[model samples]
Target: MLDIKLIRENSEIVRDSLRKRGDDEKIQMLEELVGKDQQWRQSLDKANALKAERNKIAKQIAEVKKVGGDASEQIKRSAEIPKEIARLDDETIALKTRVDEILMRLPNILHESVPVGADDSANVEVKKWGKPKEFNFELKSHGELAESLGLADFDRATKVAGAGFNYLKGDLALLDLALMNYAINCMVNKGYTLIEPPFMMRRSAYEGVTDLADFENVMYKIEDEDLYLIATSEHPMAAMFMDEIIDEDKLPLKYVGFSTCFRREIGAHGVDTKGLFRMHQFNKVEQFIFCQPEDSWKYHEELQANTEAMFQALGLPYHVVNVCTGDIGNLAAKKYDIEVWFPRQGKYGEVTSCSNCTDYQARRLNIRTGKHGGDKKSVPHTLNNTAIATSRAMVAILENYQNADGTVTVPEVLRQYMGGKEKLGKV
Candidate 1:
């Protein structure tokens, strides 16, 4: 959530950001919020004035009684004042509720560096790493190659759980674990504490981490319960300090989180439905950080560098894009997507997202930082990046490393985790 003070003081900045995002509806919502907020302030002032008047009337009533004069008129007027005050109080509460509702739904302000565009097509490529490998023979899709090598059972997975699911068998299952282990070790070596967050979170806490639209579009809710399966480890890790204040000395709290995420993928369509590229369940290693506001942009680049190094070690060809305003979504002020080369698709697919959310999540979660036992406090900035989404990484690996002989050469970094096996072949 944006700071209401910022919105009130520099509304044109917010308006310009929404315009860049092409979000006219929210522009109108902002106007509504401003009007309602002004009304709420006015109503509160009236209520406070009435309260002061009532106090004065009470004093007058007591003075009249002390002098042995009739106090009936003063007492009667004081009683009537309370009824008016109560009515104004109710109006003030109602307006506040409306303002807060709109505030919660507003997108975070965009950073000046973000590209102005309508969608992903306008995203600017910032960097490219490694080269896309050339294949002499026709390449098979990751799904087909995995099945031909007896490394996965998509047919059975589909029969049991419908589409958008899969079962890894033999060496392929080991590869998945290897990916997670490799990512965890890489992040840990970089001074990020490893954490395995809860796979589920309550709606209230979830709201603090992501846009509420995810409730219907992305999240999987538990039946008859207030819990929702987390869409990413970032959600739980970010919410860990919700409604709490951290000491300023711990300004930079970094964590590498691991979790099996669940998503509904509602309205998703295309060839990815038949493969691991898009799945309902997947394991991910996430990098999350909480730091002072001034340092967030620096940490954002650092997070991107960490993911780039991992991909380089795994020998995956990829490129980074500075996400455009429209594609950056509601949470992050600015974002970068790491798109890995897929030989079969003849293109790059997003395997990681690095974002600097600034103080958006902190404000929504009510997380703050202050001196130990001190009264002063301010919201800290939050950031998250995908170290590896194992499923997509595996897709990239399978397509890029497939040999003409139907074997998949294991990336050198993952070989140790896969029992020193150099290649994965038919079971």
Candidate 2:
């Protein structure tokens, strides 16, 4: 939630920020909350005054009783005061709940530089890499290519555990592992600490880490349990320090989390259902950071560069798209997605997303700090970048490196990781 103090003091400024996100309804709600707050405060003031009068009259009654006079009138007056104060207190509590509820539902205001638009179609392209390779013969989708190379088993995977699951055997499994290690190494070299966060996260903890809507759309809630299968290492890895204050000297703590993430794949009925591109489970090396608000944007660029470097090394053609304000989603203030070109699909597919969420996520999680604990307190900014998503990367690797004779040539950089093999052709 955004700072209520800021909202109350500079509501128009906040409105303008939200306008960039095209959230007019939320802005209206803020105005109504302010009115409720004023009414609640006035009632509280009246209730407090009545209580003060009651206390003063009680003291006089004690003096009168000591002098052997009637104290019945004073007692009756005090009784009314207690009832009045209690009623006002109840109203105040209810009003506070309403205020907090609105605050929680309001999405983060967009950063000034975020392009204003409705959807991905309006997302601006930041940069483009190598062109999609031209093929002399027919190009096969990742599913066909992997099957031919004895890499993936989709039918068996579905038999074992419903749809949108996969079994990456042989070189494909090795490739997934290699991608995870490769991404982690790159992030660590760029000053990120590597972590293997727990695979399962409780609903309470997960809620602090992501938006409420994600519970239905993206997460897998454990039946009859309070836990939810984590959709990304980002969830537990980022929530580790929830409701905690960090030392100023420890500013900009960065972590690269590697884990197999699980999602429900809800509403993805007939979308990307063929291969590993969209799956119930996939490996990911995620980059998460806690930084001073001022440093988050700079770190955002650095994170993008790390992902870009990895894509370039993999010998894949790709482009960077600056996620527009509305399309940037609720968490991130500004975002960039690295979309890799798939020769078979003949379209760019997202392989990485780098976002600077500013202080939005931190404030919700109550992750805050001050300079030396005595300085100005503020919510630390949080940022997450997809260092590598193995599912999507496989699409690029299989399609880009496919040989004319049904072989997949491993990128030169990954050869060392593959025991110095020049190519992943038929053994």
Candidate 3:
């Protein structure tokens, strides 16, 4: 949600942002909100004037009665004023409700640093890490290699749970657990408090962390219940401090949330139907931060650097891209995606995304910070990044570490976590 005061004072800025975002419909809605607000203000003023008149009349009637004069006419007039005031009050409340409905539909204001673009193709690559290796032999895709080694069982998974699901068997299952433990430990070393939050959240709380449209497409709401399964740990972590005020000293709060995330994948077809690229459920270690407004940009960079370090430690080649305007979404003012290289596909696929939401979510969640009665309250900024999505990490590992003899070499950093196992899928 955007600040209505900002829209009232700087409507041109909001209009131009919507234009740049390719959302003319919201621009029209802004006009409606302004009109309704004006009417509400006028009605409120009328109601206040009537209230003042009623008070004065009551005083006049009391004085007349004290002097032994008839006060019946004054009493009748005063009663009529209250009925009029009540009617106008109802009108004002309706107008305010309409205005609020439109406000929720408005997107966040774009930051000045964001690039103007329509889609991901317009996104600019800011940096590149390690190079993609040259293979002397034909490289097998992650799915092919995992199935041949009896490490992944998609057929049984489909029979058990339908499409877009898989079962990791043998050493691959162990590798998945190793990746989760490794990522959590890495985050712990970086001073983030580790939390395993609830896998489900109430609809009211969920709305605070995501766009309203997501309720229909992305989320899995339980039938006849107010609860919805979380799509990421970020959702629950971000809502942890909803409708609360924190002390200024606790400005920069950080957490590494681990959970089993679920997505509906409603329309996904003919894409990664055989592998783990797009799954209905997966494990993730996510990074979330809440900090003062002045320090959010600094924390955004630090968050990006932290994810890059994790990838480098795992020996995965990746690059960073500055997300374009349309593709960045409304939650984040600016975003950076770390696309890790997949040797079999000959392309870099997105493995992690870091976003600086800059108070956009804070406003919706009503999260603020200030001293008690000494300083003015202000909304804090929010940021989140994927420390590691275990499935995608496994995808990169299976293809990049594949040997000519079909054995998979474990990344040196994760070997200790996997009980000193150096390789997987060996007979």
lDDT of each: 0.93, 0.83, 0.89
Instruction: For residues 1-427, write the lDDT of model 2, one tens digit per residue.
Output: 6777877798877788778778889879878888887777887787788878988998999999999999898888777788777888898788878887887777777777788887788888989998788899887777888888878888898899988888888788888887777888878888889999999988778777788888888888888999888899988887888878877679889899999989876334332337887888889999998988889889999889888999998879999999897788778888999989978767887788898878878888888887664767878889999999988887788888888888888887777677776666542
Instruction: Name the better of 2 and 3 by lDDT.
Output: 3
Order candidates by TM-score, high to low.
1, 3, 2
lDDT for residue 191 in candidate 1, whole number 0-100? 94
- Candidate 1 off by > 4 Å: 55-75, 266-269
The TM-score between candidate 2 and the true structure equals 0.90
- The segments of candidate 3 whose C-alpha lies over 4 angstroms from its true place after superposition are 51-75, 266-273, 373-375
Q: Which candidate's lDDT is highest?
A: 1
Question: For residues 199-269, what per-residue lDDT tens digits would candidate 1 score against the true structure?
Answer: 99999999999999999989999999999999999999999999999999987999999999998883464
Query: In every candidate, how many clashes are there?
Result: 0, 0, 0
TM-scores, each model vs. reference: 0.95, 0.90, 0.93
- Alpha-carbon shift of residue 332 in model 2 (angstroms): 1.0
Measured by TM-score, the strongest candidate is: 1
Question: Which of 1 and 3 is the better model by lDDT?
Answer: 1
Candidate 2: where is the Cα deviation over 4 Å?
44-80, 266-273, 371-375, 425-427
Report the CA-based lDDT of candidate 1 relative to the real structure: 0.93
